[model samples]
Every structure is written in C-alpha cells, then in structure tokens.
Target: MQSSHVDITKKSAYVDAHIHLDTYSGAAQAAIIQLLEDDTLPLDYVVAVSMGLKSSQATQAWARRYPQRVLPAYGFHPEQALPTDAEVAELLAWMDVHQAEMAAVGEVGLPYYEREAAAKQGNVFSREPYVELLEQFVQRAAAWNKPIVLHAVYDDAPLVCDLLERHNVRKAHFHWFKGDADTVERMAANGYFISFTPDITYEEDIQALARRYPITQVMTETDGPWPFEGEFTGTVTVPTMVRDVAAYWARLQRITEQEAAVLLRENARCCYGY
Candidate 1:
C-alpha cells in the first residue's frame, strides 16, 4: 500500500477521534484517499470506528492503505440487533488476532434510541441482552488494556458507566455524549473523556457541556458519514470540520483556536494511544 502524503507540518494537526469511513460511499471513500495523497487537507490522524464485523474488516483495509494516517477501532453498534454469543465471540477473536494493528475496541454501548423503533415494531427492546453484549466487550477492553470508544449517551450513559466501572476500564472515550449532569460529573471524576461533534456549533446543550466539562478531558470528532444539522447541515462530514468544532470549544472555554486545537488533538492521541 502507498503511504499517505498528509502533511503534519501544518500549524495545527487535528485528530478525528471518531469517524466511520467504511460507511461512506465509494466516491466519498475515494475522495478521502485523494485528500490523503494531496497533502493539502489538515488532517493528521483519523480513528475509523466500526459498526459490526464487515465494518471492522473495511476499516482494517483503510488502515492498511494509510498506515500512518488511519487508526482502526472495531466493535458492534448499539442500535443494531444484538449478535449471538457465537458471532460476538468471532468478532472479538478477530479483533484480538488483529490487535497488533487495532487502535481500540469501540463504537460499543447501550441502545439509547431503539425504544421508539421497537414500539413501531410492536416488540419491546430488551436492555439485558445489550448489557450482556457490552459486558463482553468491556471485558475484552480490560484484558487488552485498550481504550474503548462508546456510543452511549443520554439516559443510557450511566448504565455504560457502571459497566466500565465494574470491569475497571479507565481508558474510555464517550463520543457525541449527551447525558445528565450527575453522570457527566461522575465520568469527569472518574477520568473518562468526552468528545463533541459538529452539532456543538449550534446545539445549546452541547455547548453547555463543553463549558461545564474540563477542557483537559475534551476531544473533537466528526462522527463523519453521520450527518449533522444547523451549519453543518448539507455539508459532507469530514475531518476538516473538527477544526471548526475546536474553535467553538475555544470560544466556549475562552481559549484560542490554536490552543484548543492542540489540546483536543493531544486528547485524541492520549485516549487512543495513537
């Protein structure tokens, strides 16, 4: 595979702590490839998160293509149907086998948005099975000593927090986090990190969280391939947007964009050890 020409000499190097590049279309994926080769884009490293087995495999391919620029994280997403134990074991074993190339075990957590969908289907969504699944991943993270990226948010955040505590996993990053004050405070106290997406630019609650949470524990993410609203609406989600998100955090925290950018970038590398 050819090495990426993404320049790291730029004033500020940004790290996208969470993005699902495999979820993008062929053209979008090609665009990223071109960006990496052009040396104009201001992206330093991207942590590509997986939704399932196939996503993880595709992510690994990208990581291989851009060894220095792309970091891969593998795990199951919460909103999807829970995989059986055998399937879950297969995925975890695959991740472990590729642990030498893996950045983390991630994109895992409880389903916070499945209730309404379950109601429409005339079936109740059970949390127990998902909890069991999450426990398995958490155990793997602990055993491997790799940071775990989380999809847990809102009311569901506390449950995931409990599991993390039970497993004694300290290196956890809660991407696009949206939860209560108590949960946020506990997470902060426990030394867990939280990152904001482009939504922070217009979302009052996310802005508030940015101000309340210590900047030392904050990071930035595009959650790319995941659309956004407000100013980000109609824009293709990309790592470049993390620059603007850092600026927003700067204003909210009363710091310069350069300072915010550096801190956030370091936070990413610190959490994922990339």
Candidate 2:
C-alpha cells in the first residue's frame, strides 16, 4: 500500500475511531493491518467495532494478533433484526467474558435507518426492543468504565443521550454522527466525542456540523468497507483515509492539518483510553 502524502510529522498521528474490520475479507484485513503497521503512514490505531457476536469474535482475534494496531469494540449493531432472547443472552455472556479486552461497547444504538425504511414501506416499526438492548449495552459500558460507540443519529440521538446520561457514561463516541443543532449542543455540553468520515471533504451538511462542533471533541474515522463519494469515490475505504478527513476538518476549523491530526488523535485516545 502506498503511504499517505499528508506530511504528518512524528509529533502527530491519526486514529480511526470507528471501523468495521470484520466486514472485510481475510486478505483485505491482512492488507489493512500491514498498512497500519507501516510507520510511514501517520495512522496509529483503528477501533474495530463489531456487528454482533460473530463479528466481535473476528475483531477480537485480529486485536489479539495485532495488538499494536487493532483496538476491538464489541456489541450488536442496531440496523438489523433483533436477536433472539437466548442469542442476546449468549452475546452478553461472550462480551462479559471478553470485556477486559474491548476498547468500548459499540456499533450499538437505535435503528434509525431500518425504522425509516419500514415507514417508507408503510409499516410501523417499534423501537422499544432496540432501545432496551441499547440501554443494556450502555449499562454494561458504564459498569465496565468503557466508552460506548454509538450509531445513534437524528431523532434517535436525543434518546440515546438520555441513556448515556442516565448511566453516567460520559465517554461516548458517536461515530459518523449527524443530528440537529440542539442535539449537537447537548452532546458537546456533555463532552461527548464525534468523528467525521472521509465525506467531510465534500458533504456540506457534514462540513456545517464540523464548523459548529467543538474541535476538542472531534476525531476522524472511515467506517471502512463503507464507501464514500467525492475524492474517495470508487476507492476502497481504508483506515488511512482518516488523514484526509483530518485535513478537510482542519480547513473547516481554520487550523493546520497537523494540528487537526494531533487533536483528533488525542481525542480518540482520551475517549477510548488507548
């Protein structure tokens, strides 16, 4: 893999606050790990978030193999159908057994996209179960003293905020976040962190959010294997792309790219405790 041309100095590095490493093929995962191991790239760590038990297992394996690069986050993603009661119990048990190894409890929150799609199909979607499940994860994160990575956005953001506050989980990272001004202010007030994807290089809404958001609470992510547009169009999403996000975010915040890279990296380290 070609190294980044971002001119990152030894004083700074980038951390991908969120990514689905388990979604990639084994070969692709190996290639990405190789890039992460490359000192030439200004990348430091990739927080590999899981979709469920299976995904968590895979991510954990990678973390064990490449402890220097992969920081594994374990939890069920909310965009899919609810797992059975027994399955949920099993997953919780698995997470309990591996809690010490996880960076956070994540890829978990309310199902905004799925519910909206259901509504578009003229179907009523009940969010009660997802909310319950999210609360459980939030409770565990609070008890474990771990940051909770979130998929909550828009209207769902406020509700998830309620859970975080109720549990006193201040180290929340809302990855690839999108929300209204009030929610943004609320999250900022709570000292919660949010990450920008490569799309920040082009998306006006995301840029606006970047402008409104406090840079101290900001970080960069790729949510890799999830493609983007603009300059990233047709290119495979990789963790190194966070350098591009940090660069664009610097322009948005009117700071130097190196400054953005250091701030974002430190924010992720603070939030994830890595």
Q: Identify the candidate with maximal TM-score.
A: 2
Each model's TM-score?
0.92, 0.95
RMSD of 1: 5.7
lDDT tens readout by residue for model 1, 1-274: 1122223343787888899989888777777777667566768888899999989999999999888788999999988888887888899889879987788888899887885578788997788899889998899899889999998988888999999999999999999998999999999998899998899999999998988887678888999888899987887887778888988888887766776777777777778776
What lDDT would each prediction earn against the true structure? 0.85, 0.89
For residue 43, model 1's alpha carbon misses the true position, in angstroms, by 1.5
lDDT of 2 at 17: 84
Q: Where does model 1 exceed 4 Å of error?
A: 1-10, 120-122
Model 1 gets an lDDT of 0.85
